[model samples]
Target chain A: MDRLLFGDNQFFGVNHMSEEKARAQSMKFQDLSAVIDVLDAAYDEGIHTFMCTTHDRVGEIVDYMRTKPERYAEQIFYPGMPYAHKYANAMTEDGMVGAIKRFLPDGGLLDAAFKGGMSVAKKDIEGITTLLIDAEMKMFQGLPTPVIFLQNVVVDLLLGLGFKDAFRIFAEHVRKKYNAEPGFISMNLPTLLKVLKEVGVENPVVCSNINKVGFRMSGGGVTAYEKALNEYEFQAIAMSVFASGAIPPREAIEWVCKLPNLKSIVFGASSRSNIHSTKVLVDEYWVG
Target chain B: MIRIGMVGLGKMGLSHYSMVNAHPDVEVVAVCDSSAYLLGLLNRYTGVETFNDMSKMLAQSNLDAVIISTPSVLHAQMVKTALEAGVNVFCEKPFSLNPSTSRDLTELARSKKLVTQVGYHYRFVGAFKEVKRLLDSGAIGKVSHILAEAYGPVVLKPKGSTWRSKKSEGGGSLYDYAAHPIDLVNWYLGVPSEVRGTILGQVFSRETDDEVFSTMVWPDETTAQLSVSWSDPSQRKMSTKITVFGSNGRITADRQECQTFLTDATAAPEGYVEGWNVRYTTDLTDEVYFYVRGEEYSAQLDAFVKRIESGEIEGQNSFGSATGADEVLAMMVADANRDYAGIAAGPAPQVDRGLFRRRTKS
Candidate 1:
């Protein structure tokens, strides 16, 4: 039976916590540890998936999994760079100039990485690769233990990266664009689906509500009853189920039940009241 | 007791039909529409007499007021006809295409001393009343910036004219969807000094613009930005949400349902409706009952009737006024005519890059 997954998506005291406290907490548990705690709580509460941000957390998450090799035996971190999810440390006031000097070397590290045959240590390559994998795996582990990377959006930004590095490129794209615009994290469903097919992943694309909200607010085609959302090729996490709140509870319930392959909804509410309203999915909707 | 007549048999019309039919101080004695099927539906739904022609229904029915739910363009003529025949009028919005027409209607109703109401229902929403209270009480201090968004696609008719595709019929996203926000912003800002807007045919390749965005400046030098569109592809009903920012706090309201917020730097308390009835009462005078005692429709209709009976034109005019709807349309039209470079040449702007961003480093 497909059940609705609901849980807090933000940290405790998100509203009440001071920015200093939040920053300190984020820094103290700067790596995968923070993500693990959240996922553990969410999983225990029946939340099967979660999203992760931060580079240090990536390494921390992978390191924790290393201690439990058996639990992560079958898992594979999709290979990619941390371009999209780059660490703030990489561009800090102190680090930016150094990075430009070290990587760019007058030309830039991005330019240098493409120029091959420069003698490189296996240790260095492995270390960089490990950090990259750790980041992706940390995000992965935030999902249910058996969670696999479901190529969610087509992320046009990920296009052209070779097959082996497609997933890594996808992550980089996310890191790069997540906040460049209001709905940057949202990828075109149809495009993402096509890329996922080419990448040969059978994992379902769980559509997010980030784009849907923006599109809906702009009076875009997001509301088309026949939009790509209703198409059979995709599965979705109705992120905006409580979108307008203008829709009667009964009507929203009926609408969700009619979807062809709707798996679950990723509620985006933050307030306690908003979180409570999430019960509309289980109570009023799937009660029958 | 005030006597009333009803027109149209759609959901809104039927709602009013029942509202008046069930009122103790009011009676829905006559009804009219162009559809016999609808007439039959109304007959089965209510005990009132129905007619195919409005004139016949108006001439024969012993009514002191008429509720119109016909298409927007027909509102003015029907309202004028009803008033000429000595009937008080309650009609729906898009308040006759432009401000001049709305003014003309208001003047005509005044001269005849007819009680008139134009349906801009959000005024009755609980959240809005609270927002008004906050603005009045200096809860948000001197309001400076306002942003309103109301965007959603048109629910297309199966085999009828898509009037929203034409400019002549007051058809377009600007006049259709923006009417609510225009009314809303104006209601909030009193009278804005200057209005500038952009209307475009973004998704719909039809004749009229499918999307429109506007920025209005109030007399107090406060500014408001509104975005409206009819290109939403989903079948979901969307609405206007207004966010007013001031020196001390911010207030946001879900325009249709009236869910609201007012917060200062320390902590923001959000209100929720609880208990058996789930009535959302505020820290204000207006109490919004989510589920009206099954008597709200009748209550509003009864109010309309009392306004006519009392000959209190000003009170009814203020409550059901369509004063700001057309000015928004006029601004939308003017903004649509502006060149992109022209707007860019004029001012320094604040741009919201959005909430999330990629981490560049550790």
Candidate 2:
């Protein structure tokens, strides 16, 4: 993984502090060309890792990137799966069977259907879980996806549901099938690391809110996160490092870069200057 | 009598079967379903020719029309095949999963001069129809804003087991439950020119959305808000309600009743006056030929059969209407996706209390 992973929240219009700014950013990036332009700026700044949700539009970006292989040769995509909105929209339009048919990897319909049916009949969570993973991974086929993530919504829900075994199922399948590391994003980093360890996942790459202000960091806030960082063997990717713009850029990056066990920081920006400045700051403060 | 072929013996299929079979001017000549058990049952009851394949049914049925109640993903292909086979089509909503496909089907139907209808039964509901009539008559002058809401308790759990929860097959509240109110919006006001502030989220369902909220603006400057939910426990099975605010007054309508309140004297249809007026669906004067779970279903079917028999190519509920509705649905979904990905600012600020007082005093 890169030391600094570029996040897609800016392109997608996700601002925790100001809904108005989010909407404005959303209107600005309605065009794919605009998104590509910003990404190019980030890439020019030497930040090649893009951590993104599997929104339907991201599929278009993937297709565009695939067309220009050399241009994006070193580009890495960290696709977060079961983009709940995509599935929700698909299910709304096509129904469950139709949605499955639409999203299932090409040439694996029967196998997936059998697996799905068997999973339903026999309570085979592994089969069902892997099948869904494959479905979500369909768009990333033929691309450079080094790390596939389970989105926070599902991760937190499974955590709440006490479905700890799913983490192992996801990790193993991602490694075995895609040959990629399976990453988990959650609001509660300490508990997730605990669950990942219980499921026998060693040195897992966990992404969560880690910043000066402890914005959205739950289950004991920054104190618990710091303890987890010191105690756990897993690599940590700090996100929301801006604390939803509550903290200054330098102070936030300065505080997060000094944290123990922190391997990467994922941040979103729309302009080249922001990207370049953030990159400079991270390089200056990062010990490694 | 118009000969009809029934396709897909699911819930909607059986409902259409009963309605078509009961209509005096229609004869259900054949039926098609993947399940032999359902085919056998229908054959035993209706004595109609049955086929396991749609192509076989289309070739041998000698039907004048086909009523398609299959999963929405199958609509484009089925409607295209039926229309190319020279049979009119009455497809269940939405017209197709994609707007382009829906447009293509509509073009084919138009080139063939076929009578077509998309099942937006709410349009046929007496209360809604009256609302439409009132709007058309300018009962509420210069409409400014509208709120269309459809809520039900269909998906309350983490069950992503069905096609309704999938996006590929057009399974979500946006397509299934929201399409009604969306179609109503398109019918009452033109298709929105701009859509923003969309929020499509899952409440309890694992994969698909149980709630959708969006803001749409028409070219006429009429802004509308659409909120559809399949996870609201407070709602009945399927409740569609709309409130229209115009310069003159406001009108609110659901399946059972239409209520109106006029602030000043305005021209309204007969039986409606200047003040508060409420009309129950039973008071509707337009006679529906048949009644089932809803008169709208029967009325839409009756209109389709009548148009086919009379060789009329276009009218309300035509392919054009369905295609228009499908386009608007596509826009709403697209905007919702954008909005979900788009940033959220805080809620728009409220009117200043001092300004409000000053304006009132003036």
Per-residue lDDT of candidate 1, residues B272-296 (tens digit): 2121111132222121111112222
TM-score of chain A of each: 0.49, 0.90
Model 2 residue B83 CA deviation (Å) reads 1.0
Model 1, A51-125: lDDT tens digits are 333334444555676677664443333222233313222222123223233333233332333232233333333
Q: How many residue pairs clash in each candidate at the backbone level?
A: 30, 36
Candidate topping TM-score: 2
Per-model TM-score, in order, reads 0.49, 0.54
- Segments of candidate 1 deviating more than 4 angstroms: A1-288, B44-47, B153-166, B255-302, B316-320, B339-362
